[model samples]
Each structure stands twice: as structure tokens, then as C-alpha cells.
Target: MKQTNYYLFDWMDFDESLSKDESLWKAYTSTEVKAVDGDIHITVPYQKQVLQEDMLADTDVPQRDYILILRAYGDSIVRMFTSMVDDEMKDTGSYMLELDKALTHKPLSVEFADNVYTIKDNDGRTRARIDITPYNTEWWSDLQPGPQPTIHLTVYPDGNLAKGVELSDDHFSPPRYDALPIGFCLTEGKPDRATVSFKCEADECFVGTGERFRKMDLSGQTFYLKNQDGQGVNNRRAYKNIPFYMSSRMYGVFYHTSDYCRLSLADHSSRSVQFRNDRATIDTFIIGGETPERILFHYRQLTGFPPMLPIWSFGIWMSRMTYFSADEVDEICDRLRAEHYPCDVIHLDTGWFRTDWLCEWKFNPERFPNPERFLKRLSDNGYKVSLWQLPYVANGAEQIEETKANKYISTPTGGWENAAGTSGASNFSTLDYAGTIDFTSEKATEWYKGLLKNLLDMGVKCIKTDFGENIHMDATYESMTPEQLNNIYSLLYQKAAYEVTKDVTGDGIVWARAAWAGCQRYPLHWGGDSESSWAGLAGSLKGGLHFGLSGFAFWSHDVPGFHSEPDFMNSVIDPKVYMRWTQFGVFSSHMRYHGSHKREPWYYPTIAEDIKKWWRLRYRLLPYIIEESRIATESGWPMIQALLMHHPEDKTVWHIDDEYYFGRKFLVCPVMNGNDRRDIYLPEGEWVNFFTGEHFEGGKWYRNVEVPLDEMPVFCRPGTEIKVYDEKVDSTDDIDWQKVKTLFIE
Candidate 1:
């Protein structure tokens, strides 16, 4: 759908934010205007804003950041960045990635005309206009009186802003040692981590904080943007932490900082949203669009896009905790053939090497006596093979000494120094065993990739790039402090593996665990270890949805979580949970049936028929999935999208996480909490249930949408066209794509 001009709409999208009583658009207006050098400065008095509250007049008011001039990025974009200068005029530069350095910087041309400061560029288009106003008086910490300067941006063609900072009057503030001092702020005596909130309805919410396991709409919750490796459904620490999020407010905000930050949506403040980065400067990009999907696509232009994968990668991948020996692998292949189940890729997880969880690239001779013959046998059985490995060289391994000898190991620091208030103190999961590979050193990356390449030559098709989150913050790097490289370490590790694989063969992909902004440059990523329960299933889906909105298009999860560990809470999943999780997985971009326990359909005979049915459906719809994968590569839209992305105008879809649009056609609502039914909200159109072919009108809720244990609630929207294979195919290499039948619903 083509985007509509936002200016024509009577209501601003942000009005749906939790702060419904006070509209951000209605409360503030242009007052005074001036052309300051190359920028436009417009000011608005606070008597019209929150400062007007009668109840706050007696109480000591907190200092608020004054709104300043606006900068236009050529035609389609505008930006706001704070250059923090202290009393001495000393400044702290931005600590985030300098993304603008790579883009075209079009200088702004400012002109004063008709009492309004007109801001334009070389193209002679009036991008924005600034009208200044008398500043409002603000009370500082010592009850000092001061006037606050204000600036407002008018995105001429109507395309931006609604995200700005407001300081809350609070005595308690977190220590930000890692951030350059900014108590002395940009004009307004705002707190170090200041805030700008959306006055939205209760229904408005937030989505992308990469790889969160809880609910998708993070409206009232406060999560610190620190990359701590955590497990379980409740733990707040995440393996992937990218400080970027898309809002139901119809805009995208990304704080370009590697430091700790906090974003609150009508949580602490009764009527406003907030943003506080650990650093001194608040450098961010606010992208606007008619729909969340288009905003995401524009956001992708700043971050990187997901890489394309080989066609065969879209097929089913089978794995267990170990698949230890060659004979065990062969027996599994033989059993799949006996059951007439379609299997394309088989993974040899941990214990395939000399020792379990050791980053040894060599295959264990005891387990696989002959790697060559085993590879040939699997190839003959129509299977591609993948091996597992991580970046750490285990302490006792022979390669540990060898890796250190060659200066590849990360040198230990005296201790964890440079603690960043909360991140360094609150979360501690320090690994004592091995040193991480120093990827900043090109020699180390090449050495590790060389080892992986040697294995790829032998038999392994791809490596399950795992466990990159637990880097030693004290470890030495050639350039930046290890603390600076902490969150992005996964990218360096995954990039080495991906680039090496791509160099050797024409194709490469990694089923990785963690990521940052540009990590999507590597194709595939999977959810980390999850327990075997409905909550875990929901968490995996939630995490995928969150990660997808962050520009990482392709994502997968442990179909039924690998819930068995010697020390952790572990158990085989209830058959019902496994079946339901598999139903959701079947529609995902990449399908994989994996777990610590025996995940084979034969092992759980009760759901065997259901399992086979879903597996066959995966293959039958392979051609359609492959085409969608191609579209995803071009558009940066995920194969699985929250219903909110496709139907932003329909407020009902904003809160739905259990059901989402799969590949732009089907609304898949997986049964959660072991319920035999669920409530599904279909957005504005006609849709038909996949199983019963019963049609229903959209824009209404279907209560008690009966979803049996054997069935997942999937509905096809109108104007859908896709391919269906006539028979179950064992491997993607064998399927005749030209012969598959196509189905179109108009």
C-alpha cells in the first residue's frame, strides 16, 4: 500500500499514546522565530505546556531541557542531536556509532521571511519553519530561577518529530560513570538521561528493544539497555541489546549510543514518555512514516539489511542436544525415510568434537571416525550438515595454549574496571574458563575463520554461531576498551564466520544467538536456550517479533526448547506444548525442530500425526516461503510481522502478540497457556480460517476461536497467492519448483 500524506490526517498518530488527556500536538505551538546562522531557532513558552499545572506551582519544579534549533537532512529527513557543552565550554562527543558520517550531508539554508524563519536546503524546498517564543521560567536544583528557550520543527511536507526531552523533578538519579559528564546540559538544566514523551492513549505502546522475551507492547515497563546474557522467561537481561525502538506513535527513535540508557512510556511520569542515555550527548534519529512497516524500511536505510540465504536454508533443520556419532546420525536419517518425513538439513550439535562446549573446530575421531564418508552418506540421503561452535577457547583445550601463543586470546584486565553504575554492578555472569577471540585484531578473525573454513571443506555446511554475549568486559582490545565493545562483540564474531563462509563458498548463513544494529548483515539468527513450556514458546515468539522490528529480518527459535541441563531446571516438554510450538514454527521463515530431548516425531507418538502434517505442510509451502524470503531481502520487512505493522490504523492489532501476519498473507494465532481456544482480532479485510475454510469479516474480535491441540489458528487474508507442492519432498534440492500448484484467494 502506498503511504498517505500524514498532514492530511486530522489526528496525529501519537494522540493514541497513553497520555490521552493532554495531547503533545495541542499543548505546544510556535511563539517566536529567528534565523541563527545556518539553523532556525523557534521558541515556545511553557505556560501552554505541563509547566501550567496549578498543583505544580507551589512544589519545586525540576529543570527542563529547552527545545533548540532543528537540522534538516536534505529533503526527506531531519535530525536532532545535543552537543553537550559545560560551563567552561568543554564538550563530550557522542559515544554511539557515527552513522551520519557515511551519508550525504546536505547543508541547511536558513532565511527569515514573513516573521517565520524558513529552513531549506540546496533544493529550494522549505523543509521546516521555526517560530520563536518568549521562554518559560524553570526552577533549578537550588531553587534558582531561569528562562528556558524552546524550539519546534515543522517538517514542511509533514513527516516528523513528536519525540523530545522533558526533565522530571526527581532527587534520585542513577550514576553514569561511563558517560561523559552532562549534568551541565544543552541549554536546559535537564538530568543526565533526559526524557521526551508521547501523550498517547492507553493503547499506544513500544516494540523494538532487540531480543526481549516478555510481551511485545512495553508500555509501563522500564528495561535497561545493557547486553547481559540471561535465560528464562522472566529475567530482564537480554543477549542482544540494540537501543532502537518503533512506536505505535508512528515514528521510530534510535539513541545512537553504546552506553546504558532508559526509555519509559507513561510509566513513571503520569503524562509523558522519557529517554535517558548514560552519555552526555543525546544523539538520535526520529523517522516518520504512514505505517510502522514503512518506518522500519526507512530505519533500515540507516542500519544494514538482512542478508540473503540459500534456498535450501528455508527447509527443515533437525537437531538434538548431541547427535554424537556418525551411526546415530545415519539412524536418524533412516528413521525419517521410514516415516516418510521431509527433512532437509541435519545438525550435529555439541559433543561432535573432542570435548563438549569446547570451541574446537576439529571433528572428534571417536565420534565420527571418518568425516568424509559420513558427509557423502548424508549427501546421498538428501541432507545438508551444520556444526556448532563459539568464539571462546576453553581453558583446558590444547587450542587454548596454541591460540594464546599466537596472541589470539583476549588478554585479561586487572579486574572489571570502569563500572557503568547499573550494568557493571547489577548483572554479573562472568565466565572463568576461556579467553574470547579478539576479533578487533584482523589476525585473530582470520585465524578463527580459517579453522572454521577447514571444517567447512571437510563436510560441515554452516556453523551454529553461538554464545557471543558473555565477553569479558575486562578483556583487552587493540582500540576501544572492552566495555565499549561489549554489546557489539557478537557482530565481530558472527561477521568473521559469515564473511569467511561467503568467501569460501558462494553462500553462507549462521544460526546465531546474539546481535546488534548491523548484525543483520549475516542472514539467520535463532532464539537462545528456552525452557519447554507454553510461556517459553510465547517468549520465543515475542523475542523474534521484537528483533524483527529492529531490522533483523530473519529469526528462528528452538522449536520446542532444549530444556535439559545438569544444573538448571530442565524437563521434556508436555506433548501439547511441543505440538503447539511446532505449529508456529512451521510458518516461520526458517523451520527447525530442535531440543535437548529426542525431538523426533516417533519419540512422541501421541503428536506424531500432527508433527508429520506440519512438516509436510512446511515443504508443500516451501516455494511460497522462498519467494517471500526474496521479497524480505529487498524490503527489510520480516516474513513474520506483528499485525500492527500491516494494519497500523486498526488500534486493536497494536496489542496482539499471540497472532501475527506470516509472510503478509496468513494470520497465525498459536494457542498459548494450553487453551483449546484463543481470541483473535482480524484487521480490516476478509479472512478465511486455514483449516475449516470458514470466512469471517475483519475489524472484529472472534472470542473463543477454537484451536484444537492438533491445530493452530491460521487465517488467510484476501488477495493471497502462494504455491503448494502436491507431495511431500524430502529435500529442497529434489523439489521441482516449476510443477508446484499455485493458490490464489481474491
Candidate 2:
């Protein structure tokens, strides 16, 4: 479907009204300052223009004053908050910040001299400088609103006061009509909205903001920081949106809010990066680092680190859109083992309930007559059962009336009759007028968990927490308004599922699709709904690379893509696409084969042997993958790291998005296009090809490197040792730890 510009259709897609007009925007002028507990707090009274016959008069407009707080976290990270209502800005009571327990809050010293406030760290090194002078403000004309006092934030990323870089506000004059004075402006029409603009260098690049699929460098793009049903992996719509970005200038900015916002990174204006939020406060944390990895490390410290997943989750998972009956599942498992394909999990998607996609949380007795016995049978055979469910209760679901009566569902403020706003529900064809589970209510969460607990008692090990993106904005919740709960809804929903799974199985895991900032604590998530094409494969890889940079560790995508051309039922996926996608899936942090059609390798007979080869290699490398996952959990690094993360000094590798480091050793350049050879860039290290033991020089691009269909282009450092299972195993449970052997790359 074509995207519509109708503002009322999808309000999340619309820009905030404050960015439209400059005259309605106002700034708070600094009046006084004080220090409490070594933290600097400034009081800026709100200012408005008094127009008499279209002429400005020196008159004060009495309104609430704004409080700006500046504090330090350790020596590198600084928190800045600007608000009118609260003395200190607080999170939405959301779980976005699960700060590391070892994070120390250090007191920063502030000094005022020559009309400038300098903030220094414990070592007395300058961290930031604030200027609130008349020169920092902008105006258009005599009839325009006069300049108000604006706080100009200049940050010293290197802790050198002399080398401070000033993030630009809007530079507006009469002839510069392209410029809008949106630099730190509050909307007069709606007090809840705010916009902040920062100047960007001409050649600056940025990456992150969670699971973006468009490009690796977000230099000239605009991304909406809100979760939505992307429909496919080829669009700007994202299932995971984080309001944080790492700049090419060796600094990071994390916008701390749960409200839907827009991040224009040099998109509209070539020299400005503007952030507009639907919230009243401008709260952000600026982090300084010498490398991108260090920036991500501090980011993970502010939020939470990724949890270690179970050993079996690293193995191949067999799944499709709908696995209907127990007999069909049994046949697939039998064929998988018969064909010597190593598998660990079988996910039953959207077909486990009495009606397909009904999500009643009950097994279809006709298809799965004995849920417990069936799950135990699979469990005994070394396979885990992953059940699929969502947070929405459909209209015809058996538990809908119960959920409504218990007030476990989010209802419209004007009642259910006024539930017609588009929250991207039409993407999923079978969706009905449903009630979204009110995860904000503690009672509602417990009630929802009780339903899953029944299924957990029946031996299901994993829960596929799907579809937390399509939330109605006008709906009412128990604790927060819909706007407040919009972005963080996925985090809460995934947390409930992860906690319940751990409560039963002792290994917390949820195959979640949607996410926010702190969703990494839930262990695993996947790229959503991709087309079964080469472009789909490329797009999915780009999304994963950006997601890894955005503080997530484990991520997967549908093998051979999720949706085929035209439709999933009628189109036959190309055999080469399946083979190459299988190779890519085997190298990811978690591997799963799923699509609209039957995704079993046997469907494509000619390439079935090639697909099995990749599966066996994955099992052989399971030990290495598990150890790397442990490191990823402890450190903030991702399993599939972008090339720039490992070598920030190598300027040539900044834009190379197609290749990534699988763990710390292997550089995986997937065969996105089916060809006999591809170009590979070895970044500043001695690399040995994993397949043929061919040597390559450092800091050079190898064009058209000969690669076969059954082989992936993987390179590792010389003499790098990785553990591999020396024997064939049908599943992760069958692997003998004693038989693991370390293989040297060189």
C-alpha cells in the first residue's frame, strides 16, 4: 500500500506542529542559577512577546519557569534536562533505564565566569559549557518575535575545554527563509510539545535508532522514533525504534523519552539535526567516547545489557507461517532428523489456538489433542516447542468478554465505539476490532500472565511475543496515557513474557518482534516480515547491522524471507534465494527458517543438500557461538557487529554495511547475490579464509573473490582458535562437550 500524507490517518507519521511556525515558538530566559549537591540547576523564566499594533513592547508574560539540570555520570556521560513542571526529569515509569548496578554517580563541579557556565568532571576537566547570551538567539524581522535567551550547549568530547564543539541551534535571518528558529523551542499552541536542533558538520554521519532498514549511515535521512508494523523489511517503518544515535564526531546522544518523536539527521536541513518530541521536556544524555564501541558501551550502561540466551536458542529453529496440526509437525521433525538437519526448536506460529490467529491461549484440540503429551514427546526427542501469541484480544476470542470485564484491555476514552483510528492494523489481514492488553495495569499483567502460565505448565519452553507495535494512541490505560505508553509498550509486553518464561523454565527467553530501548534484556528478537528476494536479504542484513549498533545483541530474520512476491501462497521462492538466505541465517546470532509457505529445505530438492551443509556447519560452530554470546552479554557488543565497531580508525569501512563480524573472530560477508564470486574488504588485519584457507592482506579490497554456492565468505584473524564439534549431532542436546575441538584458522 502507498503511504498516505493524510495527517489524521496515521498521526505518528505527521511532524509535530511546533516545527511548522517560528513565531509561536518561545524560549525560557535564564534568570538565576544555583548549585545543589555539585549539580548545576538554572531557572529560566518563560518569555512571550507582547505585540501592540504589530510592534514588540518590553512587557513580561507571566508563565511557569523552566528548570535546566546538568549532572555527570562518571567522567564521560552527562545528563541534561530542561523542563517546566519537574525539577528533575523522570522516565515515564517505563523500564527503559535499567542502569548497570556498578554505574557510579559522580558529582560535577560548576564554575561561572565571563557570562559562561563551565561544567567539569572529577579530574577538573571540562565536560560541557553553557552559554545563555543574547547572541545565541535568532530573529527574522522587526515584526517577528524578539530573541529570547537560549542555552547554547558546547560539549568537549575529549575533555579539553579548548577543543569544545558547539552543537548549532537554528540560524535564522530575514533572507534565510529556509531556516526556522526551532533551536530549543517550546510550542506555544501545545505546551506538551518541544523541539531541539543541533548543527551537524558537512561530512558527518550517524548510525543507530534501532533496526532501521534503509541505509547504514543515516546522514541524509529522517526516521520516526516509534514502533510500527513495518509490513516488510524494505521500508522506513520499523518494529524497533530507539531514540538514540551515535555520531561520527565521537559523541552519542540519547533522547530520554517514551513519546513518539521525529529525528531529522541532516535530512531537511543540510547542516542541522533536529529532534522534535510530543513531550514537554527536552531530556538527553550526551556521551563521549574515542571509538564507536565505547559509545555503545556507555549506552548499554545507561539502558540495560543483553541477557545470555540458552544454548539451544543458538541452534536452528524450524518454523513457517502456520504449522497447523501435530501430525504435520511430527512429519517435519521426522524428515529433519532423517535428512540429518540439526534442529533444536519447532515454533508453532498463529495456528496453535482453536482458530488460526485468534490468540485465545488455548491449544486447538482437533489439531493438538494432547498439548502436554505432544510437547513432552518433542522435548524427549531434544526439540523445544515455541508457542506464538500476541497482546491483543480479538473480538470473537473466547476470553474477550473476560478480559473486558476484568478491565485487562485498553479501551477508548469515549468507549469502544470510538475505536476507529488507524494504528497500522490493516497490514495484518485477519485482525479484527480487538482490545489491546493494558500492560500498564498490574492486575491486567498478572491476568495475562496467568493465561500463559497454563501453557507453560504444559511444557512450552519459548513464547513468540509478536505484534506489540500496533497500539491505539487514543486508548486509555490504567497508569499512563496512550501517548506515554506507545513506544515503551513493547518493552513492558516482552518483559511480562520473559519473566513468565523464566519463572517456569528457569531460562528467560522470548522470540519478540517489536522492541524499544531496554528490550535487549529479554534476550532475543528478530527482523520482521521480509520479502523473499535478494533485495530482501540485503535489507534484512542492513537492519540487523543497525540494530546491533543500537544496543541489541541477538537478532534473527525469517529465512528465505517472510513474504514472497505477489503473495506467499502462490509464489514459488527461487531456489538460489533459499540457499543464500540459509547461509546468512546460519551465521546470525539466532537462526530460524520461516516464511509464508512451507520453509522446509526439502521443498527445494536441488539445493537441499547445500542447505543441510550450512546447518551442519552451524552445529559445528555452536560452541564458539555460545561463548561469543556470553561475551556479548557481558560487554555491550553485539554478536553481528558492524565493521566500523571493530575498526573505528579504518575510515574505509564506515559505509560497508553488507559485511559484519560474527562474534569477535569471523568476518562474514554473506552471498547476498547468487554468484560465483564477490568483493570482500579485509579491515587492517591478517585474514584467513574459513573455507579454503586462502590468505589475504590487510587493509585491501579483494574484488570478485571466488566463492562457491555451498560456501560462505568468512574470514578470521590468523591463528584465531574456535571450538567446533568434531562429531555430527542431530540437535544441540546430542552434542557431547568432550568431543569439542579447537580449530586454528591459519
Candidate 3:
């Protein structure tokens, strides 16, 4: 067994609270407070402690005073900052765009009494409190065994009470008095890390750690916030990682930083949710609300809300790994229209550039002769084009020399062959000797955006921003460390592409694969590469659910799956799996059919008719999808909502992951396998089957219900009305909203 090092954490003593007995941990003692520009600032001098171990003597040296600042936004949100070494605290990345505007909410009541500072609202309810009373260590020498008195911050939301304790009328006390406080960790006499620990109930559940592929509930799990190619949907690593999570305790925490972070949601100790930021300052926004929806509203307000997507962007997109020529794209479009298949966008992936997978921002002259005419012809027929590109320059590629000469590509700190800097210029598969485009530089951003602008001028409606998760974490950038810039690189890259496309074509949409907190403003993002298997389909659903919970409004996954076992050893997807995945895709916020194989419905003749049936249903439900998506963007909710988002009070719904609400009306349960039986749990209402007209009461379990492959378990709430466009059309452009009809279910 590997030995655990307790000293890595500044607060974790060898015997938990044993530091209180020996006074071996240094804590802050508040000295002065000042109010400046609607913010409270405090100076806290460190009270030095004597160390008993010689190994830790170096870290016990005296340090400067810590600066603690607190600001309130309305009644529900409180921003907290603990600064070390006078670091200028700033939002260095694109994480928070409307942070300044969010401070215009109603003022909060602030008070400090006997070393405890509290902030309340007009209702005289405590929203946040900071307890900094120094502890009398002698009392903990076996005379009094209680929680140690250290500086800590706690946010109070409505209906939060201590477990196994009831409130009395005389004197009110908060529950769970035995959790650690927020503080900094000293390394070699300098604070190098900041940690925030919150009290956790035994039944407390957490969600939304950014596109997680595991179980729905994030209880007893530790996650790292670093963007990496998830490779497959079955592991912990993901392309999108956000340092934000909401608890069933009716509160959420957004650790505001671009650096690497570690979140332990009661995985190390069952009593606390520990968050560690690898930086000198602990800057966070502690949001309290009455429900998870309210919490998400504040989170999106602090960050930016997702912009409304173009109406055509909601239509079905058809794509594959590589469409090698203009003839291939033409053939697919022709076949879809001939078969009366409804699709609005045709995406050309990897093969639009001069060389396949080598992106120089130019269409292949030989393969795509008269590109402007071709794009115009496609546009005339009510079809849009989306091209794929990444922010990487191959060594022998045409544009590498120009980019390197102009310093648009990121190299080593001093040069490409600097000492211990070979990883920055390493080869990536067939794209040998690659270099990452530095989005941090303003000149480079315009240069790259110029390339994308030219494509949009030729009628490319959208740009697929891909492969941003592979940035070297140790490379140097324009003004920030790689640790602070790698995860946010996804945001910068996609923002540039989305803005340029919207500027030229009037549609701000990108088929992005990587994301951080504020990437939702870019309109749409999709799940990364997934394997062609049953587990892959299940994992993709879980990923999308968690992504929505993380404050994203639009999300989609590759239909069926992206690749197969043994690296595309079998090109053909299983027919049943294709049919089942097609059912899942129709109800998504945006639908796209893409994989290693041909994703056209005609490929599987046995199930071709069934595939067409589901596709038509998607068109019929387009009216509901558009309204729900608009509501989601405005209300800061996800179009594809997990059951827990609406039923957080129900303990049974916390563990149910496979079931979800497609919109306000329909409950979609995807069939993942060939099995004819599955269990479905409905929460607290009457549900009517959308297909079979069967009714089932909620608040109970229905076990082993028989279902056929042709039908999924789709149910709608009682007395729900859904608008449907029942007219036959080959694309969304041909449908008129005035001809739509409504279906009322009861």
C-alpha cells in the first residue's frame, strides 16, 4: 500500500483535530476591517504555532498578513476571496463575463458582532456568515472535545438544517458544527494552495462536475478539473471540465479560477466537501438558493447566459468522420432529399482542407472545384454547411512556417528546443511535429479568425472547433501559466470561431468538443468521440445529463457512437443499436448523425423504415423543442434536464440516471440494449405514454416493463399540450409554423 503524506495538506493533521491540542497549525487572527466601494476588506495577521516535527520546520516559518475580502450580490450570492502575498485577484480568463453587471442586485445587510461577521437580506435571514473567533487551545486538552475554532465561511440556504437536529423556538443554532473552515496551505513558508471545506450531510448528493461520464450523483468521488481528450466516455478524464457543483443542500459553489483544481466531494472524508485550488488565492462565489434551479440561475448570471441559437441550428445535422470530397457531400444530400429524409445541415469533417486532416483553411482545389458555386448551390436548396478545424499546425504543413515566423504558434519559453521543453513540440499521430496556435495573443486571434471569416464568406454557416483538450500543461503563454490557461484554451478557441462565423454568417454556433464554465455563451457544444457499443450509448447520455446540470443549455452526442472496438475493426454499426440511438437523438436539443461508419438511415435496410419513423417524429416535435430551448436559455436551465433538477427532494430520483425530461412535457427513457424489459421510475404525478396512450401514476416503481425496439418508454405529464408540425417536408425551410397542430395528452 502506498503511504499517504498528511503534510501535503496544511490543515489535515495526523490525528484530525490533534493540532488543536498541540497548537501546531497557524491560523489567522482578524485585526482590522474596512469597507470600500460596497466590499468588505479585512486584514488578518497569522498567529504562529510551534511545530513538534523537524521535517515540517521549514514550512512553519512566519508569513505576511492574509487579506480577506467579501462582497454580496443581491440576497442569494456572496463572493469570497482570501488573498495571499498581495496577489491582484482578477478573472483572468473568459469564465465570468457578466460578473460586474451581476453586482447591481438589491443590497444586503452586513454586520459584525464579537468577531463574527454576517450578511443578511431584507428578510433578516442570514445568507452568509464568517466565523473568525480565535480558539482557546487549552480547552481542547481533553477538557473540552469540540470543533476547533478557525476562520471559516459558510453560506446558508433556505430549508438547510443539521441532520438529526430540530430547531427550537428559544435559541437557533446551525447544524453540523464539526466541519473544517476555508483557509490556505503553506508550502516552504509561502501559501501555494487554497482550500474550502463545507459540512456534508450523510445523504447529501452533488452533481455537475462538467460532462462526467460516471454515475449521476457525484457522491464519494474526487474529480480533477483539467481538459483532456476523454478518448472514450467510460473514464474520468473528459474534454470539458468545469469547477462548479451544486448540492442537494440547496446551494452551489463556483470556484472562480482558471488554474488546475481538485474537488473531493466527500471522497476523502465523509463529513466534508473539500475543494483545493492550486493558486495563492482562494476566490469563490458561494451561492445559496431555495432550489437547484435558483442556484443555476445565479451561476449563469455570474457567468454569462447562453445566447439564443439560430433556428436552423436546431435542425438535424448529418456528418461522418471524413467526407473526402465534394461528391460525397453531394451524394448524401441528394439521397436524403430523394428518400424524403429531413436534414438541415450537412457537416464536412476533416476533408475540406487542401489535405485531409491537415487544416490550412483552404478547400481542396482538385477535389472541390468551383467551391463558391458548390456552396451557393447547396444554400439554394435549403442546406447549410459546417466545416471542421483545430488550432494546431503540423510541422510540414503549408502554414506552419508563416505562423512560426509571425509567432502565432506557441513554442517553448525561450525557443522550441529549450531545456526540458520537448513536449510542447511533440508529434501527434499522423500530424507529425505539431504546434498549438496561441489563442492568448491578440494578433494570433485575429489571424486565425481571418481564416475562418473567409470560409464563412463562402457560405459556410458554422465551424466545428475540435481537438482543444491536448494542450501541453507545462508550456508558457503570453501572460499566464499553462496551468491557468490550458483548461480555458477551449473557451478562447471556440469563442473566436463562433464570433467570426456569427459575424460573417449571422449564426453564432460552433460544434465544440471542449468547454469550461463560460463556454455556454457560444451557443452549442457536443460530446467528444464515443465508441460504437451499448456502453458507449449509455455513457453518452450520462455525459450529456451531467453537462446540462453544469449550466449548459445546448448539448448533443454522436448518434449510435463515434468509433468501434479495435479501432474501427467493424465499420458497420449494429442495426438495433442504430435504431435505439436514433430514438435518443430525436429528443435531444440538437440532433446529429455522425460516426466512423455511414450514419444515413438507408444503410440499415432492415431498420431503415423504423429510423425514418423516428426522424419524422423529431420534425413533428420541432415546435416543442424550439420553445423549450428558448425557455432553457432564458431561465438558465438545460433543455435535456435530469430528473433531480426538478425532483431534488425525492431521494429515489437522486439515484435514477437513465431517465430524463426532454422538455417540460415529455419524459424520454432511451432503450440501450436488445432486452425486452427494463425498470422505469416515475416521480410524483400522472404520466401518459406518448405512443401507447397508457397511463401510470408516479411515486412508485414499475419493474421489468415489456418494451419493443420500435418504441421507447416516452411519457408526458397529464394535461400537457404539445405543438406538432405534421406536414411532410424534406427540411425545416419548407415547414410553415401556421400549419402546425397541437396534441393534448391526459
The most accurate candidate by TM-score is 2
Taking the tens digit of each residue's C-alpha lDDT, what string does model 2 give over 1-746? 12333211122222333244222234444566666786767676554433221212224645446677777776667777786434355533447887776767666777888887777777888877777655654555576544444556676744855434455534343212222222223334545556666777888888889999967778988787888898888888999998998887777888888888888888766777777777757888788777887888888888988889999999999999889999999999988888789999999998888888778899999999999989998999889999888888878888878887888998877786666643244355455746789999999999989988999999999999988987866678898888888889999999999999999989899998998888999979999999999889999999999999888999999998998897655598989889889888888999999888879989899988878888899999999999999998888689999998888767777688889999988899998886757888888868888888988888999898777787788888889999999788999999888888999877
Runs with alpha carbons beyond 4 Å of true place in candidate 1:
1-75, 83-106, 113-118, 122-131, 135-203, 415-432, 564-570
Tens digits of lDDT, candidate 3, 513-583: 99998999896899988888888899999999989888898999999888867656356788888888888
Model number with the top lDDT: 2
Worst 10 residues of 1 by lDDT: 174-183
For candidate 3, what is the TM-score?
A: 0.90
By TM-score, is 1 or 3 better?
A: 3
Instruction: Name the better of 1 and 2 by lDDT.
Output: 2
Tell me the lDDT of model 3 at 508: 80
What tens-digit string does per-residue lDDT give for candidate 1 at 1-746?
A: 12222210111122322333331111134455445554555453332123221111112333333344455543344555553332111112322232333334445667776556776766776666655434454555754333223333444422343432222222122110111111221213332332333333456678887887767688776567777666654468788777777778677766666656666555554344555654444555666666777767666656666768988888899998778888999999988978888888999887788776554788789988999889888988889898887777766567877776776867666422431211221121232345778888888888898898898887678888877876756567766577667777888888888887777766778888877767787869888877778778888888888888887788888878767434343465688877888888898998887777888888888989879988889988888888788888767489888888787777676677778877877788888777688888878778987767778898888898676788777889666777788776778877987788988765
Ranking by lDDT: 2, 3, 1
Query: After superposition on all CA atoms, how large is the RMSD of candidate 1?
Result: 9.2
Candidate 2: what lDDT?
0.79
TM-score per prediction, in order, is 0.81, 0.92, 0.90
Determine which window of 10 residues in candidate 2 has minimal summed lDDT. 5-14
